[model samples]
Target: MTSQYKSPRPLLGAALYASILDSLKAWLKSDGLAWLFAFKAALAAILAVGISMRLELPQPKTAMVTVFIVMRPQTGLVLARGFYRLCGTMVGVTVAMTLIAQFGQYSDVFIALTAIWIAICTAGAARNRNSRSYGFVLAGYTAALVGVPALQDPNAAFMIASTRVAELTLGIVCAGVVSALVFPLHASDEIETTLRAQSSSFFSYIAKTLPSRKAVEDVVAMHEHLITSLVNFESLRVVAVLETHGMRSRSQRMKRLTSELMAASTRFHILLHFRNQLRLSGDHQTLDTVNRCVGAIGRLLARSPDVLDTYASATGTAQRLDRLRLRVQRHLAYVAKQDGFTPVSSLNLATASDLINRFGTELSAYVHTYASLQDERHSRENWLEALTPKTDPFVALAAGARAAAATLTLGFFWIATAWPSGSTALAQGAAICALASTATNPFRLAIQIAGGTLIGGVVGTILVFGVYPHLDGFPLLALAIAVATMPGAFIMTRPKVAGFGIGYCVFMPALAGPDNPQSYLPEAFMNDAVALVIAMVVAAAAQALVMPATSLWFRHRITARLKAEIATAYGAPLRGLRAEFENGVRDLMAQQLMLPRHEGLPIRIPMAWLNSVLEIGTAIIDFREAAADITSRAGLSHLGPAQAAIRAVLPLFKKNTGELRSVAIDALRDSMLAARLAADDATLLPSERSRYRDLLTALNRIKHALRDPQNALGQTGQPSVAAPSSR
Candidate 1:
């Protein structure tokens, strides 16, 4: 009998194994902690800057920007968040200047506009679309920057504005400098992964395609899926800027490779459509040419440009096809089934051999035509468009106005209270607004800005009074300030965006009054506290009325999304499936948070219908795959009259494709009708023979799964009625 416990191994061997294992665990823990602290510290630093701006530094009116240059550390998301913060701040500054200047003397008017700004930001977040976010952020911060400052003595406003602009420029530069010095991110490996995944998807789809009638539809659907997943490459492109600091020479080939990959995707889509449209007597020559093109693209992905020359030349139509066929056959013979990829020969080899022998003469012309087509549309659907961006619960959780209000309030408090000599309420507002501009949550962002401003003010005072006078002159003091700035800058390179706070606090105080002997912390604290209270109050008021953004907005947008999904699901199954695949890509890019995990987080945005609709779309993909599988096995197109059946199939497949899509809608509609009838005994038909048999059955099954899909789908691995598979 086998014992449950084993005797101890040799002491040395056991010790070595345990030590290595322990070290790995320790390293992982250490790395994870570093990442976590770095993120929090960055955020904390940004908040500290807001505090500095509110303190009684000499020129406390300078606009301060804290940059957090995050390289996703994951190559795919390696974009610097620099632009987002920069744009948000600039827009806020402009809005603050305009609104304050226009409504300076009219007290209530400024409050009214502040409310409007909150409403606009909230509404901007209503949809899960990426493009819309840019607008929301722009508007939210603009209000904060402009509204809070106008509360100060009107004459001091312009000077505050000038100082604010100067501070902002300084903040932005500081952030960049810090980012460059810290751990920089890049996009090299991410682009490669995207291409590899697409290649991998093709082979996986092919495995699901064989012995299937809707083969072309499967191809089209899979093509769209990969395209969507890959487009997020746009985010990576931003990392290209990191090259200016000089070290991306190795990836110089990336630009061309990416372009080629995009071109190939478009070409593959065309070939798939052609295969679906071909007749029973479709020329084998075209098939061969298409095969060659697919192989060419795969080769490009699998090997570096340098490695490809080792392969034998592929000149002429038939020769090219042979090279492609040879490569594919090798894959089919060698690749493990779990690998989920192989060349196309195993898919249509019978059609291939016969076509080569019978239509050898036509091969060159078809190849020529295919090449021309590829050339014509190669650049249209690029990796950038495939994955550029979208919206989600992340946006819903965003609080734009709260942040703007916080910053503005802090600035306003300092000006109204008269702590910092040269600073106006408007300048403070501008600083707060700019800092809060990039925050997803207005409240949290406001806090961060307030905290940062305080920290910066403390540092500035310490340097200006505690250190400045002792220094020989302005130049020496400036030198001292610059030395203090390096560490702050280094910290800013990480994402928390807080390092800007340290720099602001250290330098802005010196800018305000050169080497002043007096310390200003006590008065600065009073002004900061007052400003915090006012900003919070203003933000709350704005959120409550005059175009409030509520979950109601989320419901409206999600409802519309649900209807669109339903409509797409009801189109011709094949083509409708294509559209659905496109929507999947949008979801993948915009809402980085994966679904089915929604319940893990507290419900932030109130779009319950969207969650429901997304489930429905997921169901439709499964249904389409299941239906196609059954239809293919039945050989619906080639029943008894084989040739005639094949001829008849084109129209039916082409025509019924449209009608079949209505099947989903009909099932939904008929189920409602059946439910009504079932309630009345007089209208009930024999349970098994009811006119609504199919529709009712489909509806009941959907109902069962909807009520408890985890159990039905068997995620827990107990007994279950499986939801239809997406093949």
Candidate 2:
């Protein structure tokens, strides 16, 4: 039967299809989120009721809504956010209490201090464009969460604290429950898949670099894509902890495993800039041989990142890998090198090829490690995350920052103005806490805060008058809890923000809403609106000042990925020994495609540069590989003994394709190594004279442009924008 199988095309198609299915699964899980709100509401109600019953009072808690905000989307992030919240809360409360105590009740000084704290937190939140900054904001707000209500009744501090604690614990539990019961997304799978893909494409590009002489622009784009792919893992870390039971342990393990993968990817980009050092400027065959051998290693690393253990004892591994990295670096360094016209790019190409071959051999063991551990390493994180921390610092901070800042600022603002309503500031802080958590855009957050607060206030008024009057105990409470979800329903998808708004409207009124609507509705609306403005203004101001992040910072994340892919390609030969090489290629392709793909400077400038580099490199590689597949046999046909020896090892490329490709390419590598020694002498043997002359002539004709492939973290230094758009 005539075979229908093409080289790598069909296999590549299958992997692409597999990735599409995985993305679809993620999208499905992201939607259908009612359970999250249900869980939050039930917990909030339970805490409210428990505290109220224990204290034996008109209301057990005004803090239930605040508790729900304590947990965050991811565990580690929650841990961090929780830590910041704890610290910031402690600070804010101490300051509020101290001011209030020193200046007495209704002191205008307290309002000023609150405003300051709000601004500070807003500034801190602006520093990082992520949940981490939210912690700072929450810290500013935590003060009000505890201190504001105390203003209403100083003696009830213990009751307030207890109620808050209960509500917070309940809310955390709810987050876990909701996430667990729902489709339950585990980000680890996505992380691993992307990592693998980036690795492969990188190595594929690197291997073909020698023959195709692809430009730096070609591979630069891959680097941008690579950074995005890896960073997405960080994002997923936030979500992974929402699992139950065994999932927590698995998540921990995955984190460790993934961290190593990240480091390796970074190193691969380093290799791209160094690979050129191995070949003589004019030795084309030597360079091709060098690339093939080293590229095999690069491919292996990509395909078998999870299986490095097998290579623990590999021979000449580091030396060979470093040789390629150094050579590539030499080539790339020339562009930046001030010395101009020096040809140090070919300094050590031959030695590096030999090292790559040794590393390739060691990969056998690494594959063994992966095969043994792949199942356990891959599936357990999802299961382990079942019992991880429910909330992260990001959410807590967002809640705390908005809450504390608004409460204090508004509280003081009202007092200074001799405002008729004392709770107006408190009300605004509460609403801000809820709305900010869910907003993706700051302006939108402000708008939502206003809209949500107004609606929430109306909901509160209706309940306070219509429902509370008609029903007394459980029914009234249940209705109120259900109503807490009026805005909460919008939060089903953006729960943090939605919950933020819902909390204020539902909790404030439930805690202190008037029993009748005739004369009370107007006052409630006014207070809510004032509070909304205070929180929004404070946040916006702070965001504008201290360590503010522009969109450029967000864009740079993609540049970081491109660099990572470059280095990862260089390291592949030391990793996977089988079809793992192919897997690495697909992994990069998927991740490159996965970036949110928006417009901007830090992201686009580097992205355009990195993407073009990686793409061109990838295309050049594909063509050469195809050419090698068709013409390699013919090239050796003239060398009878060598040709017969190579033919006997037919299908070598297919068989030892990944890291093992170095092993098969070793035949060519051995010849190049010999040629290098001959070049060094400046007086070649008869055979060397012919081969070296031809090789050097060929290499010169092939392009020598190379640079460090963009890395995952992009560059260490955050360059300041020269103009308005650059930063």
Best by lDDT: 2
Off by over 4 Å in 1: 1-94, 118-151, 155-163, 166-233, 238-388, 392-461, 482-526, 529-566, 569-727
Off by over 4 Å in 2: 1-30, 33-61, 71-95, 114-138, 149-221, 235-256, 270-283, 294-412, 430-444, 472-480, 483-526, 537-548, 551-602, 606-727
Ten contiguous residues with the weakest lDDT in model 2: 383-392
Tens digits of per-residue lDDT for model 2, 1-727: 2376557877999999999999877755564234444444454445455454555433344334433454333334444444555565556556556655654465455555655565556546544434555566555555556556665666765565455444444434444444334344444445446434644454455444534344333444655455555456545644444433343445554444343343344234333433432232344444554565455555544554432232231223344455555565454344334443324333334233323333333333223322333344543233221211112233234433444555555566666666545554554454464335333444345555455545666666566556655766665665666555534543534734653454454444433433222234656656554554455566444333322222344334334433334333323343231123222333333333433344554344544434333432332232223223323333333333222222222232112123333333454344334433444543333443444434432222112222112321122243422211110
Q: For model 1, what is the C-alpha lDDT against the true structure?
A: 0.39
Kindly give the number of clashing pairs for every candidate.
42, 112
The candidate scoring highest on TM-score is: 2
TM-score of 1: 0.47
